[model samples]
Each structure stands twice: as C-alpha cells, then as structure tokens.
Target: MLELFKIKKNHFVGIDFGTASIKVVELSYVDQKTILENYGFVELGLANRGNMKPTSLEQVLNDSLKKILAKMNIHNAPAFVSIPGFSGLVAIIELPSMPAEDLTKAIQFEAHKYIPSALDEIALSWEVVEKKEEQGEVKDNDNFISKLKLKNESDSKSGEKIKVLLVAAPKKDIEHYDRLVSGAGLEVKAIELETFSIARSLVGDEPGVFLIVDIGSRTTNLILVEKGLIQANRNIDAGGEEITSAIVDMLRISRSRAEVFKKEGKDILNSNESPLVVPVLDLIVGELHRVISAYKEKNKGSKLDAIILSGGTSKMVGIEEYFAHALGEEVRIGNPWRAIAVGSEMAPLTKALGASFAVALGLALRGVEDYKKK
Candidate 1:
C-alpha cells in the first residue's frame, strides 16, 4: 500500500500503474492555466495475467516507481494513484430524497447490496445528482440550505426525483495501495478508480453523450459518460499483451521482440500477420461491440454521441480507424493534456504521451485543489 504525505499544496504528481507500463505526471500551477512540469513512463518487465500473483507485481511496481521518479526528478510531492476496476466495485443507485446527513448512511447501506465484499471492510463515497422538484417543501437544514433554495426557485414540478451515482472500493484494496505508496516514500492524498479518472481526463466538461474505451495492457475498460456524469462502466479481460502474445506465437519470436513488433509495427509482414493480428484486433473490437450494444439496449432511448480511445494499447497503429470502421461512428484518440499547458517544442511527445497518462493526468488534476473547488 502507498502512504499519503501531509503537506501544503504546491505541486501534484499522478502515477498510473498498468500491466505493461507505469506512467507519472508532474504538474504545477501557472498564471491561469495548469502547466505541465514533467512527465515520463516506465515499461513493466512483466505483464499482468491470472497467472501473476499480487506480491510479485507489487515488487515490480515498487522498482518501477523508483526509476520513474528518479528520471523525472520528482521527489516528495503529493501523489495520486488509481486502483484498477477489477479490484473493486462501482455502481449507480437511486436513493430516496433525504438530508445530506443521511446520504452517507444510505450509500453505505446500498453498497453492501451491490459490492461483493463485507460492508464494514469497504471504503465508500458518493455525489448527489440534483433533479428538478415536482412537489416538496424546501427545508432549511444547514447542510442543504443552498440546494433547497435552488430547487425552490427552479421551474421543476413538485415531487420530481433525480438519480445519483455511488462509488465504492474495499478497504483491503485501499490499504494495499497505501502500503505500496508508503514503501515508495510518497504520500497518497486520495485513491481514485482508473475508470473515473479516465472519464475525467478524457471527457472533462464535454456535454452530450460519449463512451471512453481504455485499452490498457491487461484489461480493457469501457465507460459511458453523459453530461459529464458516468452512467455505465464495464471491464473486459483483454489488452495489449494479448496482441503481443499473438505476434509472439505467429512469428515464433521472443516476448521482447514481439513487444517491439507490436509497438513499432516492424517485421509484421515477415510474420503471419493477418492470421495473428487480425483476430486479436477483431476480438478487441468484438468485445467493445458487445459492451456498447448492451449499453444501448439498457439505455433504450439514449444514443452514444462519440467514442474516445485512451490507454497504452490504444496507441497501436490503425486502432482508431479500426474502431471507427467497426462502430460506424467517429472515434478519436483522447488527449489527456488538452486542458493543460505545455511547451510547443514538446507538443509532439505530449500528444504521444497523453493517451498513456489519461488516468495519471486525471489523478494529478484531482490534486489541483484550487481548480477543483471552482
């Protein structure tokens, strides 16, 4: 588990742990825009799979942190790390109108019904989604005075109800991340789930409806966001390593060599490219298709407006076109740094690095306390 450092806010560092690599981003406040201080990534020596144990992966994470921090000259800044979705649970639930004091209890009670872990062993948090009132008297409680006034002044009818999204994770998983950060000599101010972080960095204030497909090294996460709120999410058990493995088996090459081919698109023709690459790509697209179709079926009237791709594996050549072709929709690679300031000389590299740092950038964005309060 990672340790949290108590300090005054000046800079923030976001660290993302992926199956094939780890990314870190350092940011500082500038005039009106958030300036990018420094950013770098470390490739993991091992890839995550069902066969890999958590203990072995923890060591790799520790070593990777040491190298990433040293190379970027980052030491002792408040850090944010994201927990993988597979290790926790996230759900959206409808709760009856209640005082803010009772919301926490309501969320906890609801969590036990949705989360597989014991209620006492989980850490939880939730945000209220305000709905137009159809019929109800405005209460003057100290906790909700502002909300009551806003609701009363609105044109909504009495007794109308709104929906809220609740997110929870097991305490054991939180402790595990805390231990890792503490071991690495970094403070963990907050722990965010990767899906939420990706949504934050990719979607931001974008309106309407959009789906974010995060193709990581070991898992592919699908997130549906509407009006800046996460409406649905799912994680698939496939990622970049599958593509690499296919290349390795087809070309009869070392894992390291296959990884190079996967990234550089080198020696692809020499190998049985179509039989290997085509199927892996098709599998990824197929899973995405299923997830999207299910989302559409569940939503009924809602339609997906766009598709944004992020994560390390999303950098594969022709992937954007592949998704666009399969989904028959506009698919764009996400730029995590779109809202942050960067030097012109570094623009090209920043664009390349943005996709990989979606979660990390979102984590760092959280550490920007002043900006968030506004």
Candidate 2:
C-alpha cells in the first residue's frame, strides 16, 4: 500500500504511465502558484521501428524515461506516479464515529468485505472524510452525569457516523512502479491511483458533484467526485481502441490510418461514419448513465455539477457536444492546465494536448500542494 498523503518537496515530476503512452510533467510552486516547468511523452509502440525486434515493456519504458529526461534536462527530481484506476480500489466506507486509532482498526475490518485479496497482499491507505458527533448523557458512578455535545463539520442527515475514503493497491504493483522510477534515477515520492490524480487536477476545490469520464486507449475510467473527493469508481473494458477498430472496419482502413482519422474527424455524428462510431460511444454513455443514476440515488438532494471528459480519446472532435447532448449535463473537456501558469508560447500546445496530461498534471500538483504548506 502506498501513502495517501506524502509530500516533502516543491520541485517534483508527475509521471503517468498509460496504456498508449507515458506522460511526464514537471512542476514547481512559486508565489502561491503552480507553474508548469516541462512535459514530455513517448508512445508505447514507438520502440518497434521498422525491422527492429519488439522490445520488452520494461526495457521500452526504461529507455524512454532516460531519453525524455535527458531531452528535457531534468535530473534527480523526486517523482509522483499513477497506477491505472482499474488496478486497485477507491471506496468510501461508513461506520460509527470513533477516534482516529479506532477508525483504523474499523476500516481494516470493513476492508475485508470490499477487497477480495488477502489483506497482506494489499497496500491500504484511508482518510476520514467526515465525522458526526452524537448527543447523549452518561452517568458516572451515579454521582455525576455528563452531557455529550456534538459538532458537525460537514452537513449530514445521519447521526454519529464517520465517512472514510479507502484506497488500496497490490504491493506487487507498488514495487513494479517503484523499480521503474528508481531505475531511472528519480526518487519516488509517492504513488497514487490515477483516479485521485485526475480529480485533483481537473476538479480541484470546485464544489458540487463531478463525474470524470477518462477514456484511455485501453479502458474507460468513470469516477464520481464530490467536493474534490472520490465517492464512487467504475471501469469499462471499452475505450479508444474499440472506437478506432470501428472506424477501421467501417471504412476499410489500416489501424494507423484510423487513429489519424479519429483525431481529425469532426462532426462525425452527422457524417456517414456516424454509424461506425456512435454505438461504441453510446456503450460508454450507457455506463455513464448507470453510474450517475447510482450516485444520485445514494446521495439524494445532491445535483451533479458537470461531466468532465478526459484521456486521449476525449480529444476527438465534437466529443464535448456529444456527451453534453447524451448525458444532458454541462459536459466539457477538462482543462487540467487551467490551474497552472503557462507561458504564451506553450499555450497552443497545452490547448491541443488538453486533458490528455491530466493524471500527470495532477500528480505534479500534489507535490506543489505540499510545497505550499511549507
């Protein structure tokens, strides 16, 4: 299990190792602002050029990190890394109010119900989201009676309950990512689920509930966030690859060509190729509806503020409008760069890249947040 809250430095790098590519963002905190220092990425398939033998995933990642760091002139910076959302669990648990120490033991007992793996095989971290105090009277030795007072920091309808955010990942994954970064000569400051990283960068301190639909190359990660905390999480086996496959089958084009068209294609819903893409998009939309319904049912009176579209597939033209119409919410492409300061020259590239670097930006922002505390 990785530490949920670990921050010791201001200058840090966020590395997001995605299925399609590995993105790195370097950031620093200055004058109460998070400044974007540098960023780079390399596609996973780039290692096999021409007739070269296929490279091992680990070796490809190692070589790519060395080249990217050298090219960017970055050295010895501590790093925060992200594990895919599907690899672990992010759950909110409720229990009777108790001291932090007691809550820890209670959380462990509750974890056994959610996690199928043995506790020893998992790395676990949790945070108390909120606590409710109960009012009562207790007799002490029949000579004196004490009245219990309650303080509620957050609004709640229930009595004497504690809500906790539980995060866990396999220890094997922690070691694998640690080796990847340490082998590249960077100290690993922290490792967190990409779900939280995306939330930090995209949702920030914004109020209200937000559903972040991150459509990566291999899978789609759906996260329900409330007041910047994750409340629910779901993963779909479909993603951008399936969309590209639809295009390939419909238009009879090579996968390489379909990828290019997927990015360049605009108003595709109105085009003849709509049949090729709409079904796959709708599959994701269907799941989104289910997640939204479940959240709304669980949290009555809470309104969904917006739907944020992210990841590589989110760059598809007209996607914002598509989701807006489908979900009937204020759907927008998430601009993770909005929270950070950027140079005029980098604006165009940043806008083009958009939320594709969300996880990385959020990872680096985590370090910047700690620096501000100092």
What stretches of model 2 exceed 4 Å from their correct place? 1-9, 46-55, 98-102, 132-159, 270-274
Give each model's whole-structure lDDT: 0.72, 0.78
Clashes of each: 25, 1
Q: What is the C-alpha RMSD of each candidate to the true structure, in Å?
A: 6.1, 8.6
Q: In lDDT terms, how accurate is model 2?
A: 0.78
Q: Which stretches of candidate 1 lie over 4 Å from their true place?
A: 1-8, 47-56, 95-106, 132-161, 266-284, 294-301, 369-374
Query: Per-residue lDDT tens digits of candidate 2, residues 1-374?
Result: 66544543667899998878989999988778788888998887852433545346678878888888778766777798888888888887778776656666788899899899998787876656665343221111121111111123475454566776677777777778888888887888778788888888888778778999999988789988876667888888778888888888888999998888888866665355544555668988999899889888887987899999999888887788788878888998898998889988888998889899999998888777757666
- For each candidate, what TM-score against the reference? 0.81, 0.86
Error of 2 at 125 (Å): 1.0
lDDT at position 172, candidate 2: 74
Error of 1 at 273 (Å): 9.7
